[model samples]
Target: MVCVFSFFITSCEQNETIEAPQTTTKVAKKRLFKAAKAAVSKSKRTPSTSNNNHAAKRIASIDCFAYVFPITIKNGEEETVINSKEELADYYDAVEIGSEPEIVFPITIKLEDNSEETITNLEELDDVYDSCMGEETPCYTLNYPLSLVQEDFTTNTSNETVINSEIELHTFIDMAFDKDENAHITFKYPLELTLSDGSISTIENDDDFDAIDSYCYNYDDCEDYDEFDCFEVQFPIKANLNGEEITINSNDDLEEYISKLEDYTFPDFVFPIDIKYTDDTLVTLNSLEELEDAFDDCFYEEDDDTICFDITYPINLVKNEDTENTVTVNNDQEFDAYLDSLIEDDYLYIGYPLTVILQDGTKKTIADDDEFIALEESCDN
Candidate 1:
């Protein structure tokens, strides 16, 4: 009986010893997995924060231009006024890590030439910012042997291509777009990327790739029309500069004449001015409206569905030549309501001498019905 009890106690002791290591191993694996997950979460990049920091850094280092004082900026729903460079710095330093601050539109910026330009939108602000930064686009060296799947739109078929170099990758993307603007390319994941810091990071999927792939657009090709391809005003042009007749023999002459003009006064060109296109085509512009039409022929020839300009309110609107029944539209809601009130065969006219803000942030004044009609026709094209 003594031997049996001793044997049973020894068996229990052996079982406990064997189970101890297994429990410890399971707990260790759980802890390791939790730690790994936490590390991944911490390392994932926040694109908004990254972009905001980049913008802030660039703005702080800007030397070519300065923001107009008492600029309004917003973070989420909260707005703040930045009165000086010191205040801007403080705001940048104290802004929440993930919060993005947007500059309010119509803020004026002082250029190096002492000319102040009112930036009407984020695109205008970006143009100024890019000019100050020397128009640098962020790009990174991508690892080779990356696989891309190209799909044929007509046939609904796909083929895999292994890109071995950056040039090859660029050529492939360009060729794809050249064939069809709607061409689709799917990147095979688990590819590695070499960051600016010379660190290698793996892209697991499209989301991961989108986070770091910043070279998504070309700065030079962003504009609808190439400035060089646009029509050039033939020299030795006659214009009434501040109501005084003057001849601008060259671009320099025009500049000199413009410099002498009083503030807010513009040259009224004597019609019919001649313009030459790059293709050796000559167009005779009968008036300022016709000159603008020639420009529209070059710029708005593309089939763009988006609205290219915005009218500044409160613009006066008159329906069917009823000058006494003029209505002032102050906002988009009012403008929409005015449109809804219009019926077929009802002629609507904007009260002359209104301002329009173009897509490129240029402000132009419409003098009369003819100029306004020309402007509307250009936008429609």
Candidate 2:
């Protein structure tokens, strides 16, 4: 109902003097208006692109998981057995437009984690899809010089604006619909964007943009085992990768091992591995279930504070300004734990000229207390 009303408003606006580009078809104009509405709604909720349509299509296709061999699929009255990824792709290619393929229930699927799940119905399949997608992470940064098509209700004119920075982009979006909600902004297509997978996509149309929207940028593409987050797995761990026994000695080794895995497969970790938390506390995970349980709460300390900088490790912390009782902190997790463990009367100070990593990943050395206070204020800005 809401979509119908939004589409009607866009149609009515186009009937006025608001001029679309000469090359844009009427259907294209409507799609652009819809994209504009989506952008406005998503920015209001969170600063990211909307991907509801794209996600639905991906969920239907089971992009992240593999169908177990010998599963049945029906296209109208025709039934067939799909044995491999190649056969499934062929089936999709040959499926008739009107006759959508339907899955034969009580089928099994292989997830990315090498776990097999029995999906009895569409609802169960949806649950598995949600689990496979995992959590939403930070989006990739939009490149500057991006364009937006702005609509002016008062003048009945549509003009394109080029945005050069993140700040300008936010300001323009905020002001675009200030006068009237119907007057919205849409993106000028044929734009180049960097996806979460580090691939460049030429978003030539609304459909192209929608397909890449709200995509979680994976720095390492390690869906379940993210190294940048809270806990660090004590290395020299054993795992079975593609029916081969291998020892992963470090994070690099783990990455190398994962790179060698076949599609829709993951390393089967040999149990009884140790992990160290942010608080510098070590714990042993005896099984995969325990490891998953550990990751359930393994968010980084910066998530709580929204800080813009990372402090360099191995900094000296003095308790109550006593140099004799100074403690050396190696990471953000340990520092956070130390701060939390402090009593009401206890005060802690860092031994300065401390080094810190800024938001842009540059290192800076703070020589005194005044400089540190200034740095904190800078983060607030």
Candidate 3:
């Protein structure tokens, strides 16, 4: 509804103009005036995404997000972000968009402390109009820069003695924004660290910019997005922390950093509030685009059970946190029976199993029903 009205208004304003009332043409002029006003007024009104044409499309193929503990906010200052907010990802919680700005969402995050401040920055037609308003285009004036107000926060363990504990603060918001421009961003979690111990801490000082918006930028696109000064307002998540503003093209780098975080043992943790996963299933493969889809889509996390991913389905997994104790895909009764039933001469072996010792690379053995030979590793020593 908002996009349609915006398209009508911007189109009429540019092409047709409402002139002064002539003597004889009062009625015709009045109708035109009313239409022009209606268009403009409708354009100015808030867009109801519910009535959008692309709602079904969005539901069909959507982006997802998940937040996990010990999150590191890697973008901000030497400081890190900490979210005890152990959020289980529902399919809807992550973002979904279809067709373009029709179902677009430009997200801005409001911190726990700064709920009072009104979003004066990205809260207008022009804020969204300029980018979205292309002639003969959709003219989707998405309520530029959507905002996320902090609903509430709770600490796992109170800050009496400074002992650390996991904390997960829940935040949710319905937004409207341009389809492009960080519409679905994987925030490098901004987490705070305790100097004394390595335990996750939430003892935060909300003194800095109370609110953080991703689209908080001036109309003018700057050449050097290197420094914070390039933008009008500071974003919730900051890029170019240590690396020389060398922007990462994909979330692969983010996943690499997240995966190898334990190796580096980073000082601070920043939770950008945008974590996502590709699938909700257990047997999932990690891909470049899919890693960015990581929103920790774990169905649930229990205080007692530490098994991170889904454990309901029987899988080839290790027990007691030991990879050595693995559940290999061994030949069961059916498979063994099938193999035994095969004729001895009919069966073919690609390579010698016992002679050809196992190498470092991919080592899968194939055997024929020849002399019953037991295979042993040559490099056992």
Q: Which candidate is the best by TM-score?
A: 2
In the range 1-381, model 2's lDDT, one tens digit per residue, is: 111111211111111332211111212212222222221011121111112112111111123444677878776688999885456545543444234456688988765444678889866775665554566642444565676664444466665556554433443443333222333456666667665777776777765654444233211222333223466778888987646778989766765665453221224678799998778999998976566445433422222254556667788777655789788877655654555455323445667768878989899998866776677657667
Q: Candidate 2: which pairs clash? A: 196-217, 278-333
Residue-level lDDT of model 3, residues 163-239, one tens digit each, is: 01111111111121211111221111233433233343331222211111112211222122222111111123223
Query: What's the CA RMSD of model 3 in angstroms?
Result: 29.8
- Sort order, TM-score high to low: 2, 1, 3
Give the Å error, residue 120, model 3: 51
What tens digits encode model 1's per-residue C-alpha lDDT throughout 59-111?
Answer: 22233555778888787899999887557645643545344556677788776
Q: Worst lDDT window (10 residues) for model 1?
A: 39-48
Prediction 3 TM-score vs. true = 0.14
Give the C-alpha miss distance for residue 125 in model 2, angstroms.
16
Cα deviation of 288, candidate 1, in Å? 0.8
Clashing pairs in 1: none
lDDT of 3: 0.22
